[model samples]
Target: MSHPDTLIAEDLLLLLMDDEKGRLSASSQAQPLLGGALLVQLALDGAVEVEETNSRWRPAKVEARQVAGTDPDPLLAGAWETVAQKPRSAQDLVSRLGKGVREQLQDRLVAKGMLERRQTRVLGLFPSTVWPAADRQHEQQVRQRLQDCLVAGAAPDARTAALVALLAAVDQAHKVVDRGALSTGEVKRRAKAISEGAWAAKAVRDAVAASQAAITAAVMASTAATVSAGS
Candidate 1:
């Protein structure tokens, strides 16, 4: 496969630093102090040229160093394991592993060439070649099922299940898109619409709330620990 044109952004580049098990992660955010839309547009257009900019955005490059330990998140490790085996849909992976882990895994994997993403229609039809034969077949099956379920306007439970299944297929296709494994954009386009369903919206909301709670607890615990130590 061809290397994806780098999309340089003013935002820091999230590099995937993998451990021995191929469980990927990023140690620190590589803040892009320069290049913004110019970089993104170049990447979107598949241009691989690297244009140098001012040093303001460039942080001192840290020498190559080894990580002595594994990532704190086991879900992240597991997600990499799944993606390494084959391209997967972000939607499907998220259904199994929560949205946070899924999104993190996608970011890491996409950086590491293990995953790709694209938007697709609700019916899951996209013209992308990144999919392996097996994954494409799976996508086709899920697409047909979703179409049938929607056409019949099945009971609420059945409709929900069908939609969920369809999302899973789309998630796998997204991995392909992120990796530049597919050339077509249809799957990505369709999946974007499907992802906005009622169930998905609720799931995203719950995940966000839980994440906020976790961060609050961590901050509180850290403050308590510091106070006790100082006293």
Candidate 2:
């Protein structure tokens, strides 16, 4: 049987998507965030492990646990299979597992009545499909959790902590968070603290840390390429 509740990646995607625009925010960086959420989810479930690194230069490796039965969620099955194939670095797995995941996620959300898929033409020539909110209640509840954790300084549950860490990894926390009275910097600081907090096991923390590093490198590389092209 498939997992019943929405996956953590689904929640993260909903949070990152702009309901009005029917598009994702930080589109380029969203894949890694979703991938990281999956890894973190597995870690929380004790289905994957991040090998400890003794040297600063070495990247921690991720390995999937050998379970007796099939994976519960069809969405996670591919990722689990990928990890089970071999022990790989988290950064590599993030990019590899991320490919083509967005389309799958969008389809699932659309079927669940959380989103609507609209087909249109960009510039009245190029065909495009956009996913707008069919229901805002779910997304709003997630935002409330984010607001409580980041702005109200409330203690986050495991899933919420993982979501916050992933958002912070992609530098999307400030963008998605509601800053009622706090400054952007403050929100970022709290997010960073949660990302580094002792809210999860070592393996889970390592997975999150690696994802953060990967996102940082990706952002920097993109910046460099843009600068080079401009020059």
Candidate 3:
């Protein structure tokens, strides 16, 4: 199977980022989403498997197992190595696989000319880094794919389906898409449908479900931590 030059996670980062502000729209939730994207991509590439326990006593798990003729990408290879090291629940693997992914992916995109890295100081004191879009050609294509699927009622391919799932998982589908005459609710509903649609294999579906669950858990955990700190 042929894969896009950019990984799903890269595309997702682009989608979630505000091109002008150089900040992610849902910055706090990006980690789980990126990790989830990696898991689904690995499943799509036949580099990993999401095994279902189908029992109340046990949980779903992911195993690293590459197809005979396939060679995983370097970043993916590293994540695959982590998975190969042990069988873990998807939620456990989400944050683990996502660690350092954002920085690495940002640097990769910067080197590829898809984004520009800028240094700024907050209050003229604190140094900060921001990535703004340098090249929008690739991002436009990704948005177009989402447009076709969510607005035009087109059936999405595996990658597009996975992206829809990730965006919907974080409730960012309507925020990212133009929606034209469509209401935000309609766009989100369409996004939800595509996420749950029959466009991928069982393993891929399981991976998507795991990603959604992991994202929810991560968001709740972050919220709880913030509350605790404030209290």
Candidate 4:
């Protein structure tokens, strides 16, 4: 049996995708963001543990270790085991957690008939692959839930609260809904209220914060490296 919360990757895929076109939104930061979400989901499942709790969240120094007794589902179990090779900080684990992570997730969604993997040779010279949604049912449901929590002022459940925290961490909540009707101040206020609520466990919330910060830092570093190389 799969819990709705266990579908974090699928939720993320839906969030990234454009329903009308069945294409992922253009974002250079997708890899790191997905990586952050994966690690947070693993933590939420108790498959991973963070070393720090009393201090403010710090991505560069927080160490994540595997829990000894929990048996996660097969998909997450693999990630838990891989990370268990050694305890690592959120920063160290971002790209590591992301490596080939998207492909693994796409394969899972395809197996469930949520998406179809397609390949094309662009202009007969460049190879490209796309994972387009096969059905919008699941994604639409998720979006409705998001609207409820983020816009309609409904209290969030655990999974929905966690999803908001992730979206706020990356500052991408606006992309999921039409925020134009709401003030930016209102959006931030709503997010903060939910984040501080019971639906968010202290540890899980910290993990999300640390992971998103690490992902952001990693993206900046990668971008700087690219510019330096080109220069």
lDDT of 4 at 185: 72
What lDDT does each candidate get? 0.30, 0.83, 0.86, 0.71
Sum up the clashes in candidate 1: 30
Per-residue lDDT of candidate 2, residues 1-231 (tens digit):
234368888998898888977899878776776777777777777778888779888887889986555557886887888989999988888877877889999999999899999998999999999999999888888889989999999999878888898888877888887788899999999999999999988777877788778766666676689889999
Assess candidate 1 and give its TM-score to the true structure.
0.20
Give the higher-lDDT candidate: 1 or 4: 4
Residues 85-184 of candidate 4: C-alpha lDDT, one tens digit per residue: 8777887776777777677777888788778878867788898877777877787788788888888889887777777776766667656866658987
Task: Give the least accurate 10-residue stretch of model 3, judged by summed lDDT.
Answer: 65-74
Residue 63 displacement in candidate 1 (angstroms) = 37
Task: Name the regions of candidate 3 deviating beyond 4 angstroms.
Answer: none
Residue 124, candidate 3: alpha-carbon lDDT: 96
Q: Which has the higher lDDT value, candidate number 2 or candidate number 3?
A: 3
Better of 2 and 4 by lDDT: 2
Q: List the candidates' TM-scores in order.
A: 0.20, 0.92, 0.95, 0.82
TM-score of 3: 0.95
Compute the lDDT of residue 138 as modeled in candidate 4.
80
* Per-residue accuracy of model 1 over 78-193 as CA lDDT, tens digit each: 43344345433222222333323324434544554534454434447754322112123333444454443333333223223323322222233233223233333544444433
Pitting candidate 1 against candidate 3, the one with the higher TM-score is 3
Candidate ranking under TM-score, highest first, comes to 3, 2, 4, 1
